[model samples]
Structure formats: C-alpha cells, structure tokens
Target chain A: MISGDPLSRVLYIDLSRRKYWVEDRRDLFEKYLGGTGVAIELLKEECPKGADPLGPENPIIFAIGPLNGVFPLASKTVAMFKSPHTGNLGESHAGGRSAIAIRMAGYGAIVIKGASDIPVYLSIYNDKVYFRDASALWGIRSSHTVGRIIREREGEAGYRTIMRIGRAGEKLVTFANVVTETYRHFGRLGLGAVFGSKKLKAIVISGKRTLKVSNAKAYREIYDEIYKMAVKTPAMRKYHDLGTPANVVPLNNLGALPTKNLTQARFERYENISGEKLAERFLGRRLACAHCPVGCIHLAALREPYEKEPYFYKTTMISYDYEPIYSLGSMLGIGNPEGMLKLMDVVEIYGLDAMSTGVILAWTTEAYLKGYISEKETMGLKFRWGDCETYLKAVRLIVEQPNDFYGALAKGVEYASSIYGGREFALAYGGNEMPGYHTGPAAHAGFLTGSRHSHLDSAGYSLDEQAYVKKEELTPEKVADYRNTYSTRYNKGGIHKKSSREIRQLT
Target chain B: MVKRIAVLDVDKCTGCQSCVFACTRRYGEAGVGKSAIFVRSLGGVERGFIVIVCRACKDPPCAKVCPTGALKPRRGGGVILNSEKCIGCGMCVEACPLGAIFWDEENNKPVVCTHCGYCVNYCPHEVLGLEEVSTG
Candidate 1:
C-alpha cells in the first residue's frame, strides 16, 4: 500500500449509539489487501461466534479493493455479513458506482454495527457522515421509487451511490437484496434483511477526493494499454452488444440450461428468450460500472398500454442477465419474453434475490404437482409452470407472508421444502438456493463445497464445460483434485480441502 | 486553426468516467480532482449525462471574474490558469454558468480546461471529439 493512501482508513458507524469514528489500520490493509480479503478479517473481528444474523451483533462490512477507482474493471464492492438466509458466512459482490463512491469517500472499508431504534438513512459525503431520519421513506412499494426519491434528495448526482431496500427487505424476507445505482445489487444472501433488522433504509455516499499513484508515467502507460485492449477485444464487444444473456443459446444447446426446477436441463423455447432475440427486440440501453471502458449492463425496454387508456402506454427499462433468465424464464417454464421481463420487473420492485426467489417458486410448483402442497396452502392460487400472473401474485404473498405457508416460503427453499415435505427436490446447497447451473458433477461439487455456495466461488461450470469439450468423464475425486488445483493456482498458494464433518454440516 | 473538444453525442456516454480519469492522467495524476472535464448525470444516469467542459467561450465568464488576473484567455476560447498568481478565491467556480471550473481542494486553485483535447482520446463511445475552428 502507498504511504498516506486513504485506503488504510476504515470508517465504523454504530447505529445503536448514532456514533461514528475512523480508524487507520494500515496493518490490516497491508496484510489482507482489500475487498473480500479485508472484509472477511473485519467480519471475523466484529461478528461474534453464534451471533444471530438479524441481530445487532452481526456487523455489515463493505470493502473495496485498492485498484477500484484507480483502474478499470476493478469495479466491484464486496459486502460481508452473517446471512439471515443460510445462517452462515454471507458474501456478495456488486458493480456500479459503489466501489468508486466508497473509495473516493476516502475509505477502503466501512463497518456498520448495531441497530437503530427508528428508520434512518446514512448520508456520507467525503469525510462527513449524517444519520438522516427516513420515517417518510419507509414502507415504499417500489425500490425504484426509493432510488428516485433519494436521487432527488441527495446532493451529488453522478458521483453518489444509493444502496437501499424495498418492501421485501423491510418484511425481512430471507433472500431480499440491496439495490445499488437503481440496477446493480448485492443481490444474494439477504444483505437487505440485515439492513432491515438494523432499521437502515438506505445509504447515500459520494466524494470528490483525489487519489494518488506512486508512479504517474507508468500508471498512464499501463492504463492506456488496458483501455485499448478493453475497447478492441472481441469478448468485450460481445458483452457490450448482447451482455450475459449471450450465454442462453449456447447453454441451452449444450443441454446445461436448467428448466422447470431442474427436472430438465434444456428449455424447448430457449430461442425466444435468447440474447440475440432480446437485443433485437427489446434492447433499450447499455450501462457500465464506473471507470469501465466496456459498457455491458443491458436494459430491455418493455412498453405496455394502460388498461383504462388504450392509447396511452408506459415504457420501463429493466436490466437482465443470464442468471435471471434461467431462474425466472427457463426454470419456471415461462418462455414468453414479455412475461419473463414483467416477472423480473416485479422481483426488482420488491428487491428480492431473483435467483433464490425463482428457485423457491420452482420448488413450490413441483411440490404442488407432487401433491405435497395444495391450493389452500397457496392461498387460492394454483402453482403452474409459465403462469406469470399466478407467479406474480405468489411473489406478493411471499412478501406479505399472510399465512404459515407464505411465511415458510419467505424463509427460503431449504426451509420451505423441509416443512412442506419436498426435501428431495428442494434444489438448494448449503441452505442457499442453487444458482443457474446444472452442467456436471463439478458444478454440483462446487456448489456443495464452495465457501459461499455460489457459482462464482470457483467457476466449476467453466471446468465442466472444458471437460465436456474434451469428452472426459468427471468423478467426485477428479472434482476434488481440480478444486485443489484451482485454489492453489488462483488463491496465492493456499490449498483448500473441506473436511468430511464440514461437508455434512453444509449439506 | 484552434482545436476544441466537442461532445458529439451526449446519449452515447455510459457515465464510465474514463474521460474524467484521462483528464487527470494528462497531468500525470490518476484522480478527478484536477480534471477540467466532468460528466455528471441529469438527475440520474437513466435519463443520460451532461458533459461539462470549457466550450472555449470566446469571452469566458470565468476569466472576466478573476481578481488576481491569474486566468488568461486561451487562443482557442477557454481560459488558462496561472497557478502562481491565483489567490484561490474560487470566484471563477461560481462565475461560469456551465459550472465547468472544477476546484482543486488540495491546491485551493481552480482547474480550467486548456482545450488540449487529451481526454477525447479516452471516450470509448465516440461521445467526445476534437473539432478545428477558425480563430476569428
């Protein structure tokens, strides 16, 4: 780390006391670096063993890497907490102006501890921190509205990042997410529920501080090299043109696209919802995270006529990716592009983790088919595949949680299926809903053994694809060996092997 | 011929801030504090962005308000800042209608664009370009 770099400063905010302080911990920054490395250490230091995830003891830590504002594509902000969903280590990465805003605010990490007695939002501008009352902003119907209202109320327009939750988060839904920059998110493991538990409605941060580099000439030369490569690369062009939805057609062709609760690994109507189709028909805009030359975030414009006024129509710009398409489109058997996007819009409005919510819904649909659950438990709505209207209503009920069934559903698929007698087909690993992958044993092993139980943990799906191309059989021992190799290669000589006892606990 | 950076299409900007960083890099730095060019969103990014820079106004408002005569009109249009003579009163920052004069908080001096067109090379979307105009 550079001497006098603001990356060594850690800002600690205690909502319980409405007090905040800054600590210069060059020791931790030097050893752990930043982002996940520093965040995990901070979590270990502040969060006590056996701490309740939704309680005041489970601290919320947000950290950014040293290269965040200094370099392009180092745009992610790592969030660490004890998850309300899994009751275990929670880590999610989000891209937007989040990392840049946090870094420019002159801190590498922010630790939010304790709970507020009343609803409040934290406003952080450079070194100043204010706990503003959010009484009027509470219980908002749409998360987008919350972002818009905060955007109007906040001082900085482009420089700030507003991270807030919607009704699902306020209701403490176990899979609720924190929406950042209106579209990006800490989208998994219930970070928003932790915020809800703390009565933290939102956090608005911005700064205009200048960052320093040790060597200016070398920095400019390397920056230009990277900038040139990013703009000229074909891979980046694909991302800018079609985004992650480009994976849909190929995954479906490979028979790795999980459909209808993973009962099948191929969707028959995949072409209708593929990236090419979406770009041709509905691509409205493309966005990029701060400092990134490649603008990959794709938004689809959905224009529909108002019911009362036939001639009047409203257009909505909703962002989409491969995971959401798999979860809400193929996995739910909803092939209609409009319907899939509408369902996605609802999930965004409520600020729920789309993958978890889709998997949970798939479990319920299967459970209904198996006669384990009935329409009575569903509160008069039938659980059927591709019925967007019914699924929309069910999502609302899950947030509302009017009955025991909805309450169970609000917890997660793991908990819901355990109580509802569908454990065999629950499709969750480590108490978290499965991501959009069913490639081979490596992907499954990665999910079962990965620290976060996420596909991004080790990218086992990429390994599965490699093996598929080579026509090689994948065994459990082979996966374990590959995982070790992956860890040693990428994790700076650290070898990771899960113990049998730990595996049992995770499963 | 005098060359000035022009915003080709504001809608093409993704609010990436690459140009902002590039402006700073031109001075052998890596932050936006000294950058004369800024891309701020109109309320939110969803609506689009407004690129604010010295449009090379022939008679710049910022230069007219300089108490220390630190700001001299450039040949192209915008004003050039002489940091040695600058009193750092920040009068020029409030004088511009476009708010293009960025403050260097650390140095306590105004950062005004010299119409060098260094940042135009970094705009990936072709949102910015350098245009040659007659110095009438």
Candidate 2:
C-alpha cells in the first residue's frame, strides 16, 4: 500500500553498530537507472581503493532495476562487491525472488557495510530490519538445510527471497557463493566469502508494496509485446524447453565447449551429460524466476541409496544450468550425468562457486598429471578427471582446509595455480575462473579485459561466432579494443549529471 | 453460458506469477495482494506449484457466509461483491475451500476472481483457459 518513488529509496545497514537507515538517492536512480547502474555507483562510493575485499570496509550492495517488479525477464538482482577472489570489480547477477522481493520491499538498492561481532542474519520486512542471531545457523553442513530452516522460520511463503551460505562461506572460501531460493545464486567472485568476513549468514527480504508507473497503458502494451516475444521466440523457447544445459551439445558440436580443463574444446562424451540426455532421464521440474515466464531453471531428481541400508534411498532435487554443467561435467571430465549432479549437489551444499571449483580442480588434476605436486600435497589422494568421489573429497578439503594445498585451492584457481605451479592451464581470467566458451580470440580477449571478466560481461563469444561466419579477421588488439568499448560504456561507474533529454535519448 | 478461469494444466504452471500481476493490473495497480488469482510453490518449486483460483462453485460458501449480504451468488457459479454494503470482516476469505479469496490490504476488501479471463490471456503456457459453464 506504500506509494511514491520506490526506486529512489536506498537502504543502508551497518552491521557493526546494528543500525539501519534509508537515503533518498534520487540522483543515482534517476541518472544510472537501477540494478547494475545503482550498484556500480554504490560500490565505487563505499569500496575504497586497495581495501581488503574481506575487510569490514568492503560493502555488499544489491540493486534491482525499475523494470524489475513490472517486467518479466528483468528479474535479475545485480550484486556488486569488492571480490575476495578477483581483487577487482566483483559483479554477479542472480535471478530468483531476490530482485522482486527487493523491489517490492520498496527499495532500489540495499547496502550492507561494516562487520558484525557475532554471526547474524538480516530479515527485512516492509520497513523493519531485524538482525537476528545466527549462531545456531552457523556451521550448518548443508546450505539446503539452512534454506529450509529459514523458510520454515520466515512468514512470507512465495513472496520472499532467502539467501544463505554454508560451511564453505563460513570457512571463507574465496569462491564461495550465496544461494537464493535453493536453486538460484549470487554465484561468482566470492560474495559468500565477503559475507563470511562480515559475519553475516543470510538475508530474508519480503514486502507487499504497490509500484507506480508513468503510463499504465504503454506499460501493458510493452509488457505484452515483450512477453509474446519471449514466449514465442526460438532462442527463448530453447531456454524454456531444455533450459541452459541445451547449449552443451551445440557448443560441443561447434568446438566451443571447454572440456577437461580446456585441454580440449569439445568433450568427446558430451552426449552422455548433454541437456537432452539430462532432460530425458532426470528432469524433475522446471522453474522460472519470480516474473519470467521462461522456465530455465531445470532440476534433476537424484536418487541414491543410504549406503548402509540397502532399501533406503533419498531423492535430492539438484538444479542444473549450462555453466554448472560445463564446469562440473565437461571441464572435470564427468561423463556420467548422475555423477555430475552429485558433484553439483555437493558444491551447492557447501555453497562453493561450481565454476571456480571445477576450474581449480581441473588445474590440480593437470598439475598432478604433470608431477607439479604429488599425493603428498593433495593429502595422499589421487587427483583425476571423471573421478567425482575424489573430487568431492577435494571440494570438502577445500572448504575444511585440512591441508595447505586445500587452503591454497580455496583461494581460487588463479591464486592456487600461482602458488602450486600449472599457471598456464589455470583457465582463469582476472583472477576469476573462465566460463564455458572457447569460441575464439575475441572471447578470450573479452574474458581478459571485461570488467568482471565474465562471459556475460560482453558476450564476445557470440560476436566472435558472427565474425567467424563473415570470415572477419580479428586480431588480439581488435578484440581488446572491442572489449574496452564495452568496459568504457558500462564499467565506468559514476553519477553523471545529464539533461532529461539526454537520459530519454539514452533509454 | 458464463466463463471461468480453469487451471487446465497445473504442471504447466511455472510459478512465474505473471497471471497474478496481470490480474492485479486489471485494478490499475502493481503487486499481487489485490489479485484474485494466486500461485505459490508446493513446499519447494522442485515439487511443483499450486495455482489458487476461484472454481466458481455451484453453491458458493463465500456468498452464504457473508454477514452484510455484500457477497451474492451471481447467475453463474461465482459471487459478486457489493463493496458499498460490505464490511471487510474476512469471513469469505476463511469460508472458501480453495483459499482463492485474496485480501486487498490497501482497501481491506476480499478480491475474488470475477472470471473476466484477464489472467488467461497472460498465461504463456496456455495452462489457464476460459471454460463455459451453464448455470442451473
């Protein structure tokens, strides 16, 4: 029922003093728009240069766009923080109830700063912000359990977003992630580590507020147009049908799918863990973001025995996306879909970034193969591709940090490879792990130069494919220039004084 | 003959809440509180969704329980709300078996599905359809 400009309210919470305040930052919202734009400006304002990414000074900012509550695919919440992994601009986008919940909560952005003395979780209900003690919630083995606990305790059923991390984040793993709604995540560049550093465990957000639009008729027209296109479009239909894992076979066929630690672009056993196979065999359910009609989040029901009891079994619903499939299945040489799901489940339980974990494990496997470090460094365990059991153990060790090697691995592939050798095949860009694109030089250059060094940063791989079809010769310099253009356009974060006409033109 | 929103395929419901938004938009507002139709997860999304909507009962319990005679059985199966006469006692919200009675927090009124089929148009999967029923 609360009205007015919901997009202008910026909520800031200081964990150190347990204080919360709202700022009317109309300038930032009006100029930058929202989501990435607002987050970037906040990140610049709060995160000082060379500030410790894990320090109390580093801020955690979550922003949702103006179109978030109103539009379908505009369901992403952009998280900006000084990454403990990358040591640079850390930006990750997650689609869940996160954006919608935040938007409905009557805020364009929420910034959490300072560190808490004890473990705690933030619950924002309408105008109230409660810093509840999360001492019991801390050290929980499974993030899934944590989510369930939060869900049971929280009042709002479908209208809230529960974001939590597990032992990996508690242990401050640089590649740890914050899982939201069990399936979606702020799953890159160690936001979980930052949360751990702040002694913050989880955040539950829910609100019921009416949003105002300039023109309702135009809005409805635009909404229908976009919705029709999104539902009927072939590209989006593919996403809706098989979800993102549908890209596996096609990317492999095109020799662009990174496999076995990027030693090969095409995974030979791609069909075994392909999207079609997974959908055919184990697709339990398909889910959409809060507003998105494209149900791209595919869950695979993994049933396994209790090991001790012959008849006892548990069916675990594990969510799968293309990046996770590539990182956990193809990159680590996991041919079996079940094994891949198991590994992904483990990663999710521990709240580790699957992509970073896979890349790190791939580097270690290759390192072991090259005799850089033996069983001694690996805590007497053999590292091999397609061996998910040992990989699971290794992932556990990374979170537990039982040994120095595991401790190094917890820092991410770039830092781990730098310490233990095998830097050549580390498969990391800007200290973050590489995505599943092995398209061309432009892709690599985009990864190298993109602000967040993410495939999503510029989608240079698609451009590379376009250039490839046209037989356009793209040098490393040209690729870098192209990437630079994107960085300059989107990455330069600041509050720009612009005329209303200019803003209209830009929109 | 009158039409009602029918959840033809529950499995096709992805829990997007587009229908909820679409329904609320009919009131010239944004958000789901005012929407007559509701979509929620069954424990978790992996299990599935429960699409809550008015089934247009033959002998509507909501109309029978109304204290102010605000809710009256229409020619069809559903009930029409007389906002002027009604007190927001929420008796109808509890009387419904399907939990389809949505409370508009701002106005303090029971917003039930009018069977206008606005939400049916926005359902991308065609999981929702308008089915004609002859009132006896």
Candidate 3:
C-alpha cells in the first residue's frame, strides 16, 4: 500500500450518540488487503459474541478493496453483518457507485453502530456526516419513491450511492434487502431488517478526492492492458449484450436450473424468459458500475395503460438478471415475461429478497395444494403456480403481515416450513433460500458449507458442471478436498492455472 | 490544423466514468479530482447523461475572467494555463457557463482540457471523438 493512501482510514459512526469519527487502520488494511477480509475482521472486533442479530450490538460494516476506484472491474462493495434471518454471518456484495463513492469519500471501510432513537438517514459527503431526520420518509409504499426522493435531496449526481429499504424493512421482514442505485442490492440474509431494527432509513455517500499511485508509468500500462482485455474479450461481449441473463438458457438446457421449488430441474417455457428474448423485447438500458468498462446491468421496459383510460400510458424500467429470472420466473412457473417483470417490480418496490420471497411463496403454494395450509391462513387467497396476481398480493401480505401465515412467510422458507409442516420441499440450505442451481450434490453441499450460504461463495455449481464435462462424479470427499485446495491456493495469493481455466469456463 | 473532442452521442454513454478516469490517468493520477472532463447524469441515469468538457469556444469566457493573465487563448479555441502565473483565484471556474473549468482542490488551481483526445481512445461506445474544427 502507498503511504498517504486514504484506503487506511476507517469511518466509525454511532447512531446512538449521533457521533462520528475517523481512524487510521493501516495495520488492518496491510494484513487483510481490504474488502471481505477486512470486513470480517471488523465484524469480529466490533460485534460482541452471542449478540442479537437485530440488536444494537450487531454492527453493520461496509468495506471496499484497494483496487476499487483505481482499477477496472474491481467494483463490488462487501457488506458484513449478523443476519437477522439466518442468525449467522451475513455477507453480500453489490456493484454500483457504492465502492467508488466510499473510496473517494476517503475511507476503506465504514462501521455503523448502535441504534437511532428515531427514523433517520445519514448523508456522508466526503469527511462530513449528517444525520437527518427521516420520519416523514418512513413507511413509504415504494422503495423506488424513496430513492427518487433521496436523489432530489442529495447532491453528487454521478458520484454518489443511495442505499435504502422499503416497507418490508420497516416491518422487519427477515428476508428484506437494502437497495442501491435502484438496480443493485445487498440482497441476501436480511440486511434490511437489521437496518429497520436500527431505525436507519437510508445512507447517501459521495466524494471527489484524488487518489495517487506510487508508480505512475506502471499504473498506466497495467490499466490500459486490463481495459483492452475487458473490451476486446469475446466472453465479455455476452455480458454487455444480454447481461447475466445469458446464463438462463444454458443452465436450463443443461437441466441444472431449479424450477417450481426444485420439483423440476428444467422449465419447458424457458425460452420465454431467456436472455435473448428479454434483450430483444424489453432491454431498455445497460449500465455499469463506476470504473468498470463492461456494462452488464440490463433493465427491461414494461409499458402499461391506465386502468380506465386506455390512451394514458406509463413505462416502468425493471432490472433483470439470471438469479432473479430463475427464482421469480422458473421457480414459480411464471412463463409470461410481462407477468414475471410485474412480479419482480412488486418485490423491488417492497425491497424484499426476490429469491427468498419466491421460494417462500412456492412453499406456501405447495402447502396449500397439499391441505397443510388453507384459505383461512392465506386470508382467502389462493397460492396456485403461475398466478402472478395472487403472488403479487401475497408478496404485499408478506410485508404487511396481516396474519400469522404471512408473518411466517416473511421469516423465509427455512423457518416458514418448520412452522407450516413443509420442510421436505422448503428448498433452503443453511437457513438461506437455495440459489438457482440444482446442478448436483456439490451445489447443495456448497450451500450448506459456504460462509454466506451463497452460490458465489464456493461456486459449487461451476464445479459440478466441470465434473460433468470431464465425465467424473463429484463425491463429498472430492468436493471437500477441492474446497481445501482452492482456499489454500487463494490464501497463497495466486490462483493456479487450472483454477483460472475453470473460472473462465464457468463465466 | 486544430482538433477538439466532441460528444458523438450522449445517450450512448453508460455512465461508466471511464472517460473521466482516462482524463485523470493522462496526468498519471488515479482519481477524478484533477480530471478536466466530467460526465453527470441528466437528473437520473435512467434518462441519460450530459458530458461536460471544454467545448473550445472561439472567444472563451474563462480566459477573459483570469485576473493575472494566467490563461492564454489557444489558437483554435479554449485556453492554456500557465500555472506559475496562476494565483488560484478560481474566477475561471465561476465564469464558465458549462462548469467545465474544473478546480483541483489539492493544488488550488484550475484544470482545463487541452483537447488532447486521450479519453477518446478509452470510450468503447464511440460516445466521444476528436474532430478538426474551423475556429473562424
């Protein structure tokens, strides 16, 4: 690390006292090298053992790496907290202006602690931090409206990130999420519920500081080399053209896509929601995180007319990706693109984790069909597969929590099935909803053992696919051995050639 | 012959900030504080973007407002900065209507685009280009 690099500074904000300060943590940055490594250490230091996930003792930490803002494609911000849903380690990564904004704000990591007495939002402009009352903005119907309002109130139009929750968070839904830039999210393991418990409505961060490199000539050469590879690489073209949704058809064709709560491994109507179809029909725009040349975020444009007035129309831009399409589309048996987009819009508006919400709904639908749950529990609503309107209403009910059934649904499928007698098909591992992969046993094993219970953790699905290509069987011993070797190699600071080739194939 | 950077298509910009960083990288830095060019969203990114840079006015207002004559008019348009003569008054920053005259807070000096066209190479979408202009 370069001397005088702002990456060594850590910002600490205590909402209980409305106080803030900055500390130079060169020791931590030097040892950990930032991002998840630094964040986990901070979480261990600040969070007391056995503290309640939703309590004040549980700290929310946001960290960015040294490569952020200085290099391309190193654009993710890692958020670490004790998950209210899983009661364990909660880690999520989001790509947007977040990592760049925090880096330019002159901090490598931000630790938010204690609980506010009243609803409030924090406005962090460079070194200054302001805690503004947000009581008026609480309980807003749509998270989109919250973002729009914050955008108007804040400055730094291009160099800021607004992260906020919606009614689901305010209501303390355990699977709720924190939305950033309207299209990106800290979307797993209930970060939003923790924010709700702390009475935190939102956080806006911006900065315009210059970062200097130790060796200017080497920096320029390396940057240009990476830029050329990013733009000219044939693999990157798929991401720019159709975004991650490109994986839908491939995964579905391989009989690896989890459909209808894992009862089916492939969807017959997968083509309707495939990347090619979505891009051709509704790709309204493509976006990228700051400093990343590859613009992989794709938004779909859905136009509809007023209920009674046919001529009056409005268009809504909803973002789509492989995971969301699998969870909210195939997993729920929704074949109509418009219907899936509409359902996705509702989930986004409420700031719920789409995967958990969809899985919980799938469980509830199956439970209803099996007579384990009834119309009385659902408030006289049906939970049939492919019924977008009913699912939309059910999603609202989950946040609203009108009854015990809806309340259980809000806790995630793991807890919901435990209560509703459908644990056999709950489709969750390690208290987190299953990701879109049903590739093989390794995927399930990875979900159970991965620190975050996320597929991105160990990428077991990729391993499973690689095994299939090589005509090999993936036993538990092999998976464990592979994980050990992979972690050991990563700890040594270099991924071997074979691992890199496997990664390229997976991508 | 003189050349200046032009905005080929504002809508083609993905708000990646690649060009902005490219501007600063030309000076051997890694941040945007010293960049002469900027790309801001139009209200929100959902709509589009507005790229702000020195458009090379034939009679530039920024140069006229310099108190110490630190800014000299270039042959084609815009102005060149002599840092030794600059008193860091920041009048050039305020005089520019487009807010393209960016101030380097660290150096306490104004940074202006020299129409170098270095950022044009980094724009993957061809949203920016360099073209010969008649400054009559």
Worst 10 residues of 1 chain A by lDDT: A491-500
Highest DockQ, which number? 3
- For A1-507, candidate 2 gives per-residue lDDT tens digits of 224868889999999999999999988988888989889999999999889999999999999878888877788999999999988888998988999899888899999999999999999997899999999999999998888888889887888899988889999999899999889999999999999999999999998766766777887888888888988765376677877776776677667889999899888899989889999999888888888888788899998899998899999999988888999999999998889999999999999999999888899999998999999999988988899899988889999998888899999888888888888988898899998878788678778888988876666775565455445687767666774433333311111112112322432
**What tens-digit string does per-residue lDDT give for candidate 3 at A352-447?**
999898888888888998998999999999888789999999999999999998998889888888887989999888889988877787778878
Candidate 1 on B18-42: residue-level lDDT in tens? 9888888877766677888888777
Please give the lDDT score for candidate 1: 0.87
- Per-residue lDDT for B11-130 in model 2, tens only? 988888889888877766666667898788887677788899999998999999999999998777889999998899999999998998988777898998899999998888888999
Model 2 per-residue lDDT at A442: 68
Deviation of model 1 at A102, angstroms: 1.0
Q: What is candidate 1's DockQ?
A: 0.71
Instruction: Supply candidate 1's per-residue lDDT for A104.
Output: 83
Off by over 4 Å in 1: A483-507
DockQ of each: 0.71, 0.63, 0.77
Q: What's the best-to-worst order under lDDT?
A: 3, 1, 2
Candidate 2 docking classification: medium
**Each candidate structure's count of clashing pairs:** 0, 0, 0
